[model samples]
Target: MTNAPSSLTSAEPVTLSEDEAAQLAEELKQQLRQGQRLAGDTQAIERMVAGLGDKRGLLRLTFAESLGTVGSAAVPALCQAMCDHDNVTVRRAAAKTLTLISDKQALPHLLKALLNDDDPVVQGSAVGAMAVIGADAVDGLLNIIVDPNNTPMQTGLASWGLAFVGARAPQALRDAAKSENALIRTAAIAALGDQIQNQGDEEARQLLLGALKDPDEEVRSEATTLMGKLNDSGWAMPLLIPNLQDSSPLVRKNAALALMKLDDPSAIPELESCMSSEQDASLIPIFRLAINQLGQER
Candidate 1:
């Protein structure tokens, strides 16, 4: 057996012979091709975990990737690498691998990386991995969302992350929509729209209706768009007409489109008034479309 210098503990730099390097390269290729089937063999997982300490950057990265494809079975070793590996790059690579593996069992390690890892890329990978875990990740995400010390970007990402948490999302989002911070409120409302679609939840409908009066035009516009697509007959004319006179062109445009969807005759007079007075050159086309749609229904 060829004695290789320790990449993890030795002070000496690793030097690989052409034959030895070729052997390692070939091993990585075979492991990559083998994929998750490798998880079945405890002996093979040990070899792959040991290979993460290889001095060769390419070999270390390749081995980490192959182990990731090896799925949940490889997580314990990968988590050890994230925590105990002497090399920062290798530790980050392990975190990246966990993302590909997408095992929720790795969440504790990833959350540690998100909070304690100095490397931004490593931190980002943790956030991304948690996001991929979806609904199962909500508790960790809520921590990020509510932490006052988190950067705006991180907070925003946490809000965005909540959208993927399935049924557990609405109440948290409804709370976020009431936030004093407009940014959080907007993101919460936007995500809530997709969450509530076709579910016919009256509470969510009311939330959107209330949002239509938000001080922030962007929030109001998004709410208007959601209301229109809701196809809730009661919202047809009353919910949309006032928006035609909104200060923001986007709000008025979305309202017009929503009215078109409602096909309510009460919108006809309002549409005519908006059509004649609307000064935005872009909006005229939309106004004309709504008018044509309403006229056709008559």
Candidate 2:
């Protein structure tokens, strides 16, 4: 066996005293105040993350808050904490920080936290973080809504995330419409129709229309709301119309509203036919509001 160089002797472990941690923290705070300069920020980030494992969660929380704003300098250390840390509060901080840093590599961890974390606040933060990272997270985000364990918070956050991912995430939203969970399915279709606004993307638009036929009444109503927003979307019309004279009053009203947006007199017939069918007479105002503009320019 080859012998190691004698000059490469094992270095003794250096321990930081109370004063040392306080000093490091102050220095890092100074660096953080500098803002947008990662070149000289490495030493400070190293010091910050090194203390993240401190018994008091405040230290980790402080580190997280600081590192999150530091951007690139904090990326490497926060990446480590996202997976390796044990503290939940610290983990929450890591998640929020990732939102500020918002890189693609953090997606897996963010998704993991969104789906699996016990804390609702943390899950909420993870979803928001996905939005900060933008369109790149569409693939994983679409899958998140379909999971059976979705809580109300998760559903809401997933909807928020999908609302931002746009048409690129349509496949997941379409598949999500088939979920057994009412909340998940409703949220999925709502996001596809209202958020993604795939009105111009024919494939996605068709999928949204297909979702309008879902068994759930709320899902159908939500889908109708989307059709209203798609007036400028240029979506292809389907052979079967959903929410037309449907059982749900909300569905019927929204469908009339959607047709009015199309500016095709053909929809006026449906709107006119819906007069008695619109369960909520209050929405009659919508029909009255929309009728004259049916064929008028948007």
Candidate 3:
């Protein structure tokens, strides 16, 4: 049905005079206050969250971010913008900021953005913010990795981001080390050290130990690098001792490097063993580096 000129399409050229627009803006400010307080008034912010579905994408995003900035009372309305809002990027940004305004409750909405957002940029932003949100986000992000149905790449991304968040994601770190995918394993171990490097505690030590023992050479190697980083001085002997004997030459090589950082002579025998066993084999220069490092320790 063709509409008449009186019908206002969202794309219609806005023709308000400057004074009129200024007056309306002031009116909206007052309405924003009243709506926030009374709940009875369907104020300008209300109208905006409602209008988010409007065909004009830019206006919709601007309105959502504006409403999100309005504080706690604005959450119920702005949350709809998290998903119901049209532009994926805008929806993601709104979800990210809303966590700041109110709704510590918005954690769930943010998690949905992690797996469901089709845009990787959007997904990545959600991850950046999820790191801000902390431990609560761990379960969902881990689910993406451990659940095969969740698709490996997506799961890998979630694990990787959670790692950046550090020890807060211990359970996820522990699980990712078990993944068969070498990429997933490498990412998980790297994140393990990273997570521990930030929030490490006794539990983190346990998780890193598991990573140190992972069958994949890369995972074991990264785990050895992380050994030097564990917050507890006690972690040095427990982890470095076992890693010195890892089957992969790279693992043994990295273990030697870590042992040097601790200056722990206990690993001298193990490092010497690795040097003799490899004899300039698969690990080549790294093996030699380990031997030279062991010499200094002795």
Candidate 2 residues 188-219, lDDT tens each?
66666544443445555665676677777887
lDDT of 1 at 257: 91
In TM-score terms, candidate 3 sits at: 0.57
What is the C-alpha local distance difference test score of each model?
A: 0.70, 0.63, 0.59
Ordered by TM-score, highest first, the candidates read 3, 2, 1
Per-residue lDDT for 154-226 in model 1, tens only? 6666666666553455666677677787756666677675656755556766777789999999889878877
lDDT of 3 at 171: 70
Clashes by residue pair, model 2: none
The runs of at least 3 residues in candidate 2 whose Cα sits more than 4 Å from the true structure, single-residue gaps closed, are 1-22, 32-46, 50-76, 79-87, 167-189, 192-220, 228-242, 247-250, 253-298
Tell me which residue pairs clash in candidate 1.
none
TM, every model: 0.55, 0.57, 0.57
TM-score attained by model 1:
0.55
What's the lDDT for residue 78 in model 3?
A: 46
